[model samples]
Target: MNAIAAPAAADDNGLETGLNATLREPISADGTPVLGKTYTVPARHGRAVRVKAGQTIRIANPHGTQVCDTWIFNAEHLNEFLSFEHTRAYIDRIIPQPGDPLVTNHRRPIAELVADTSPGVHDTLMAACDLYRYRNLGVEGYHDNCADNLRLALKAIGLRTREVPQPFNLWMNIPVKPDYSVEWLPPVSKAGDYVDIKAAIDCVVVMSACPQDIIPINALNPLDVEFTVLDPAVSSHS
Candidate 1:
């Protein structure tokens, strides 16, 4: 097993730190209400990020029910990235322990379940919400969401649109039954509780604070979330 270490504090450069006060952004229910202080992350699933080794990113769910789909890619090589299939297989192989590490197909540690404050487990099978799904699900008007967020993140990083893949839904509640069936329900994340993870390799962390009101994932009122970067004490190699 890969050794885990405590997250380090950030210096003046915002390199290593707990939650940076200056970096926090407020998300509002009405998208237009957000002024200069807010970073509008349109709903787009399958967002990806490439954080360098030894950097930790914190995704703050300021509002309770927001769903953030996330994925990470190595800064050096995007091909060897997080595989949802591998992650699901790993989870199935394990005993469903609370804090087990989710390893990637390359046998590299992807992210750790540092905290699961919610009762419902996130969905690995659920595809990122898209325009087509919205139309098919009877919520066609709200076509753009986390999927758009992913596209924006990719564009910011200079990656083509086709590179984005299926992501891990952060706060979305996808319940699995003993009979192997699944149901989508209200999200379980509370304000301030976040899914924290230290990158195993130099990778970018992409996320979309979901904006879907038709579903209860955002409690019928989608709110905003905050993202902060923390510094790691040990190198990725160590």
Candidate 2:
């Protein structure tokens, strides 16, 4: 009888999960935000904030060329997040427009796109970049990525999610060609352009200033973006 060999184990990276500056710089100890105050998500970093139901979050593109990967999760349930696949099915489009309901995996509305000051071009097709992606891109060491940013952002607020769902890639311009090929391009939004998303339930919103300098998705440079949780009583969109 011949002995069978076991399957090879996968390669292991040295970094610990949720280990980064993000954990030390949460918007608040519990992810709650001060109403009407704008916070900056530094380049190559992520930030998480709590937006209560009926509150609107305005994400601003300060440089207009950077891509901010955005995610929303139910405060009570980290697993219940704004799913792009479910949202695409709900909205019947690839990019959501103002007034479209962003849905969750269970087909429930989690948030609504209230207003967009840009041309309304956002990508819902790409997965958040991870360390493995950077490895494939010939990066020899650990690189800051959106997937870990999501994890670190949640962990910063004493929460965790087993899965990283596709994000609503704000200002990420990936255009499909006539032959169905896609082109990774920079955002068309101008400086100070913003979008407002109103929460249907209390939720934690995470945004990462994507650090994909190798590709031109961020015009070969990543920059900080800004966000503010609006005062529901005074917000015009409320």
Candidate 3:
């Protein structure tokens, strides 16, 4: 009888044979995502995106010092979303470091912080700025805010404001005082600084280029932010 050969363990690119297994594509220069495909989240505005598992979403502050309030939702289950309380409890820290997975309200991993070029300054304490908060701050008339931006972002993705949950404030600088109090401050990230995350599950990514000018969280200047979703598994990207 002829002996049978074992199943090939490597593919053309030498990656593991299975798609759900470890990925082979490596990220360099933040994947240098296609420009035309890039979406700009204008200052004080928000945008929604659909990122698949193993793909990455890179948020860049080209002009620098801007805060991008971020939120994530499970694509399969609308009711389950990224939760600040869960993240804090799991990570045991208000802020997460590279390699830390961002969890959902149901305690499922949705995304992970994969890369960071900035000082990794961010906030998870204060809630996204809303109309009510601004009014109390002495602001008059209608104005842009993170809360509204989140609603708009959700709408773009066929969701509602009610689905919006606590966001991970990317690049925000809120210093936790010795007394356990935190103070809003300008971001330590400079121009070209960015952070990239790999989605652990299919997720809807939401972002609001924070419109907050009441404090120095954005250096008192709101700037445009760049959002790019890259699929490392795609050979063309390599």
Most lDDT-accurate candidate = 2
TM-score of 1: 0.69
| Per-residue lDDT of candidate 1, residues 1-238 (tens digit) | 1112223343321121111111122232111121112243433232344445545566667666677777676556656566777766776642123455666658677666554555535666677665556667785233445554555555444553344466777767777789988777887767766655666676656677665667677777766666555444431211
TM-score on alpha carbons, each prediction? 0.69, 0.92, 0.81
lDDT of 2 by residue, 120-175 (tens): 88999999987778778997666778887887888888887777789999999999
TM-score of 3: 0.81
Please identify model 3 stretches exceeding 4 Å from their true place. Answer: 1-36, 233-238
* Model 1 stretches with alpha carbons more than 4 Å out: 1-50, 93-99, 116-120, 139-142, 161-164, 232-238
| Winner by lDDT between candidate 3 and candidate 2 | 2
How do all the candidates rank in terms of TM-score, highest first?
2, 3, 1
For model 3, what is the C-alpha lDDT against the true structure? 0.73
Worst 10 residues of 1 by lDDT: 13-22
Who is ahead in lDDT, 1 or 3? 3
In the predicted model 3, the residue pairs found to clash are: none
Best by TM-score: 2
